[model samples]
Every structure is written in C-alpha cells, then in structure tokens.
Target: MKIDLDRSKEPSLREQICAGIAERIRSGLLQPGEQLPSVRQLAQDLGVSLMTAVQAYGLLEKRGLVESVQGRGTFVRERAIATEASGDPFGWQLAIGDYLPRASFWSQSAVRLPPEILDLATASIHHSLLPLPLLEASIQSALKQAPQSLGRYAPFQGDPEFLAVVAGYLQRQGLSLSTHQLIITNGTQQGIDLFARTFLGPNDVLAMEAPAFSGAIDAFRLSHGHIVPVPVDREGIRLEILEDLSLQMRIKAIYVVPTYQNPTGSVMSLQRRKALIDFAVAAGALILEDEPHRELTLADKGTGRLPPPLKALDPDGRVVYLKGFSKFLFPGLRLGVLAADGALYRRLLAAKSIVDLGSPLWLQKALVPFFQNPQLPRYIDRLNSILLQRSRQVADTLSRRLSPAIRWQRPQGGMHLWVTLPPFLDADSLLPEAHRRGIHFLPGSIFYPGEPESNHLRICWTNLADAELPGALECLCDVLNEAVR
Candidate 1:
C-alpha cells in the first residue's frame, strides 16, 4: 500500500504508477527486493486498469531500476549500478529527433525578467553599463539629420552608413570584411536558424558541443536536423570526435562557442581553435563561430585574457562569425551581427527578407549610434572590471567553504562555473526548495536539449550583488543536502 503521488502533473495512468513507486524507492520507503503489488492489484488499488499497471512495470524495466520475473512478483531493484544509466546528453527526448522541452521548473530560467530580480542565470549587464545615454543622443541626432531614405525599404544589404560604421569597427579587430559581407539579424538565434535552414537538409547531421545551449538545440529542431553530439574536455569541443563525426556521419557544419562557452564556461584554447579550423576546412564543413560572451573576463593571478577570435584567424570564409550586442549591450534592443563572405551572405539576405522583412529597420537604426560614440570604449572597460570582480567573488567564495564532495573549475572569463557533485544531487529536485528559500539556479539539464547527468549545475554569479554571494551559496548547499537526504 506504500505509494507517493504527483498532484500537479496530469501524467498518464502508467506514469502515475511508475512515479508512485519511484518516489517511494527514492525516499527509502521501499527496500531492495521489496515486492510491488501485482499488476491487477496495483490497478485496482490505484483505481486504474490492468493495462496501466503493466505499462508502468514496462517503464521501470526500461529504466533498469526495477525487476519483473516470471512466476514471481515485481520487486524494487538494487540502487547501485542498474539505476545509474539514464542520461540525455543532448536534451532530446530519445535523441534520434525529439525537441528539448525548453525551460522547466528545474531551470527557473526566463528569457527576460523583472528589473528588480538578480538574474544570475545570464551574464551581467547593468542598466548603466553600456553607453546608453550617448547612444540615445546620437540616435536623436540621426533622426534630425536623416534624409528621404527613411521612407524607402533598405536594400537586401543592411543600412549603408551603419554597415560602414560596423565595417570600420571590424577593421580595428583585424577582421577585414566589407559591409556587404555582413548581414544584420534580429539576434543570434535568427542567424543560427538561417544557417541551419540553408545548410542543413532533413536528417543531415550537425555537430554541436554536448549539453550545448538550449536555444541552439531549438534552432536545429526547427530545421529537423539530426544532431551528432561531440563531447567537450578542458580545451573545448573534442577535435578528434568532431573530425570523426564529420567523416562518419556526413556532418553538415559544426557550431561552437569558441570564447566563453555557455553552461561549462570553458574557452577553446588557441591550439584547439586552430585544429578545429583545420579540421573543418579539410572536411569541407562550415564552422559556426558563436562569440556571444565576447571579451568579458576576470583576471587570473598571473595569466592574461586571450585576445582575437576565430574569425580573426580564418583566412578563408569557411567560418561564419556570429556576434551579438545583446549579451553586452541591451537584450530588449535585439541586435546581432553576422559576418561571412559576401558570396555566401547574399543568399542569406534573401532568406532573411523572407523571414522577417530584414530585422526591424527602426529598432536596428535606434541602436546604431553607439559605433560613433567615443564614450563606448570607456563604458566597456568599466563593465569588464565589474564583471571581473564578480567572477572572482564567486570563485573565491566557493573555494573557501564548499565541501570536497563538490568540485568546480574557475572560468577565466565567462559568467558561470559548471559544478559537479556526488551523483546523488539532482539540480531538478533541489530547485523548488531553493526557490522557496529565495535562491535560484540555472539547472545543468536545461542547457542540454535532451537527458543529462544528475550531478551537475551551473551557477552564474555575474548579475548578483557582491554581498549576496556568501548567503546564496549557503542556501544552495543546504538545498542540495536536503534534496539528497
């Protein structure tokens, strides 16, 4: 008669029975080899049909966490090894082609949030951090001095003067690409979608970092592309597996976050970057270089931050460089830039037009004045300093008090450190308890598009106040301990 119930989710009768038994086992109410009710008895007891109970047993069998024997009753399986095999590394439901459920309760992540909450799920972007005032002034000036072109549709190419301004900025960064070579989009996601749709055919395999950003997965799902997951080590996307996938699976392209990768907060080393570039070139696969968290880093005890980007290293247009101001500038403004060879990009422009009439000309124009704002550099320097201090605070505090049972790596530049603890801790189960305690988290599972490990979590400290870190960590640790118990 022992059972636990799911009150909120309207699970199918089979899942309800499975949930009841799993919860009991998780809480130690059921011991190893403890007999479960016969399917008929379970169905009658739960007011469900016999078929429901049979299906429930089938699910538990598939999980390998329970046993069903002929001429005997079902029993709770041992909890050591047979219970440990389930994982969705790519976040797809079963992996061949399933959409990753976006943000769920385990995540507590929102695309946007109220102005008051400290959104540590994303990197820091203080309201006053960017050159907003100066940009506003320049926008007003542009409006006053503008000509008849305001009434006309901008060309398949982006705004002419805006393009010149961006091209000049690129020159300073050693990426010598003409304005015509670039295409402005709503944001990075649009650029990603365009790339996926244009290059990937249905069932065409695309390679991505394992447990990659969920938005990237959603883009691929939209295109119905089959994913080939490439696991990452300290250096970033493991190159040998990447090359192997390219050869064996007919990989269409490789998507990577070369600088300040999301979730893991690991950067690809220069040597790895070069090899990845060479691998892609040899395999004739395009590399999507996503550099959203650009140039944001805390100083190490002795090491300096890495300069230059993958686009800076590419001699050919084999790399499509994706950069967005939304990460550093303002998210609501929705501005992102894509740089590639003009030949490949001309077609992208037409595709863009068919998507959304070329990314809201007015909004792009409103945010364009910052390129001329000399105060821009000063603002960026200050923003980087604040983020650096916050990153250090997170690392230093965690290093001081966290238990040996938990392990973490301090990221040199990004907003978060990916953490791993004893396999018993599931971020999914701990989130509600933490939320009730006024702390929040970005669960590791949310970053993956499919099933993922239970022992990991991502903590982004960039957006929280410096004084808040100690208490938040304490609360988080308590939540973890509670969930495990």
Candidate 2:
C-alpha cells in the first residue's frame, strides 16, 4: 500500500495527510470502522512530523470522517453523510464543495470592493450617506463625558444605554423585549455565528429559503449544519412545501430574511408568516429572523405592500431577532443587536464574553445619539426615495431593453432584484464576463444551501447611478443574451 504524494506540492504536509486519508476512504481501501494507522505510526510511515500527522487526524475527526476510541486508536467511521441522496457523493468523487470534497472547506467568502469599479454585490448602505458626521460628533461627545470609564472595558454584558435603545426599538416592533434579553454583537454576522455555534451540530438540519442570502447560508455551513433548501417565490418561503417538509425533516432552526430579503426582494406574506409561525410552534424549532434591511422599502410602489415580522407575532418567544446596522446603516461601524429569550441572552452574552470581552464601548455609545433622534425612522423615508428612484431607472431600462430575455420582479423595497436568466445560461459562468465589464451580480447557486446549479442572479440597484442605469442594463442584457444564445 503506497501513498504517492508530491513533496513540492503547495498544500502543507498536514493538508496532504488529510487528503491522503480521505482519498483512501473514497477508494474503499479504508473501510468503515477500519482502524487507521496510529498517529505516530502514520508519521513514521509518511516520514513527516508527528505534529503534521496529528493535525491531519484532527482534521478528519472534525470533518466527521474519522473517530477516536480510547484503546481502539482512530477508526474510519461511517463517513458523515451531510447530504442524504441515493448514495454517498463524498464516497465517489474529488469534487470540491459540490457534495463532498477531501476537506469540507465550506469557507465563507469575503466580498471587498475597490473604489474604482462599482460594486453591485452586497445590499449595503453607502457610507457616504450613512450620517458619519453625526456619528463622529456623538463619539467625541461620549469621549468628553467618559467619567473615567471610556478607557476601561465595558461590563461583560454590553453598554447599558445602547441596550436600552435596543430594547425600546424592539418594543416598537411589538417584540416587548427587555434590555436583559438583548445581546450586542460585533455585527449581524457575529450574531449569526453565535446562534449557529449555539444550537446547530454536525449534520443537523437548518431549513432556509432557496435563493437565500449566501452570507447566512455560509455561516450555517461553517457551523456544520445540514442545509435543507425550501423554495421561495413571490411571497417568501413557499408554505405549501414547508407544510409538507415539517412532517419529514427534523428542522433544528429556520433562518429567514422575512422583510426585503437578500437576492429576492420577496417579503413574507401575512398568511405565509402565520403558517411559518404555526409550523415552527408545532415543530419545536427556533426561528432565526433576520431583519437588517427592514427599515428600507418603497411600500407604496407598484409591487404592493407586505406585513410585519414573525418576531412581532411570536407569543412564545420562539423567534430570535437578529437586527443589525449593516444594511440601512454603516457596516464598517460593526454594530448589530440580537434579541433572544432572557435566559438565552444571558447564555449568549456569557458565550460572547468568552469570545471577546465585549464590543467597543465607544462605537456602542456612538450609535446612541443617532438612534435617539425621533427623526431617525423619518430619515428612512429619504433613503426609500433614493432607492426607489434608482429602482425605477433600473426597471425602465430593463423593461425596454431586456424584457424578452430576462425575467425579474420590480422589488418593492430591496437594494437587489433577483432575476432568472433563460435556461441555457449559468450565473457563475457568466459572472466573469460581467465582472470584466465592471458589473458584478452574486450567483444564485451560492445562495442555495444544497449544491444546485442555477441560472438566476441578484442585481443590486443602488450601485448604479441614475445616468449609468441604461448603459449598464444594456451591457448586462448583452451579457445575458450572449451567455444564453
């Protein structure tokens, strides 16, 4: 039995060791429950360092591919089947991230755009319009009134006044959460990470809307959650399939962007929201409600109006509200709030404390005066106007030019419009071409939990200026046409 490894290969010996063991498992040389060579023995056989072999074994164990029994040494376990199709895809191919790979690097990608090319990627608020001057003044004022406290770390939980504001904010949403029930996180991403770490374990089901927000899906995948794809149409998650799926799948948690959802601008209909609440109540699963972009929407637009959030309707405290400033507010400011059950907040705050003491006292305090102004919600009207005008320009250009080939919904409030291309094209395949033309749309496949190839794409309206909208849409239409034809 020989393991052929290229010494000069860029992947380190530890990674190579992981790949080697994983390959043998796929080829059936290492059968299920078959004992693996001892770490020391494998180190000697491979002529690599003991640390390298140990790291390799650790990788396999973390991946749920190998198990260690006290006296039995490491043995190949029935490879964790994250995907339960007809047979094991991990057992068959070297396909990376499709179904199985040597190592499950379900890596969350970072999207950072340069100042030159316009970024139509994330549904984020432009920093130039984010009231930075006001925030700076607030921070400086807080610093002046520090009372010898600003220099010290915040009391392990969070800033009191900020938490108070958060509590009040939720109360307005009809949540009635106390300050004790709120946990301040670095951003919405961190709140999501904390939730993912708390409840989900390897291969546990996380039900989500298809063409979902990729950021949340990536978080769940990183947390080792099994992603179950539920379809989403004009009115958020398809309730009929959900009604059927509830009986079959043991859903651990449902992650939803209920209002102005990423990619698709579909808001959950009042009826569907009720069905979801009822289903979750019956299923005994938590609802992770993401309402980051809730404040921005042209409700009076031609697409019509929608209803309130699931958390607003949650009576049993079954819904966990993940609210953040990343969308309508500043993302770089790194501020977000999570509202959970009182006990859960305590646990999560403790968990967060163990992670990083607490969020920056100054930044937390900076958001205070800004949120205090009664004009805050009213300011949303201005943002809606800008986004609405941009959407109109985008819509008209799309209707006049790309009407026949492309299909999309004129999103009532979101920065993005989820559009499906003609069947013959691939969103990912066409993205490189679009990128070359200084246009970027997120591929719909990554938004899918399972490895599903799709022809849909998310177009962010805010990134394009009113004048550039026509030319950009025409160029984009050309790209779509070329990709399909």
lDDT, candidates in the order shown: 0.70, 0.73
Residue pairs of candidate 2 with colliding backbone atoms: none
Candidate 2: tens digits of C-alpha lDDT, residues 1-485 = 23434476557878767865765554344667666778888888778889988999999999777998776577788644222233554634421113221111122124344554455665676654566766677777777776455677776667998899878876776667788778888888788878888878775788998877766765776565666788888788887887688787688789889888877888888888988999899888898998887777866556654587788788788888888877777767788888888666667777788878888887777778777877777667777878777778778877876747778888877688888888777786787687777666677766676544478888776655556556667778777877766
Residue 291, model 2: Cα distance from true site in angstroms? 0.8
User: Residue 63 of model 1: what lDDT?
Assistant: 78
Best by lDDT: 2
Local error of candidate 2 at residue 248 (angstroms): 2.5
List per-candidate RMSD values in Å: 10.5, 11.4
* TM-score (all chains, Cα) for each model: 0.75, 0.76
Candidate 2 Cα outliers beyond 4 Å, as residue runs: 1-116, 147-149, 301-306, 464-470
Clashes of each: 7, 0
Which residues of candidate 1, in runs, are more than 4 Å off? Answer: 1-118, 147-152, 300-307, 466-470, 481-485
Write one digit per residue (lDDT tens) for candidate 1, span 334-409. Answer: 7677888856676677788888776655555655577767777677677778877766667776777677678888
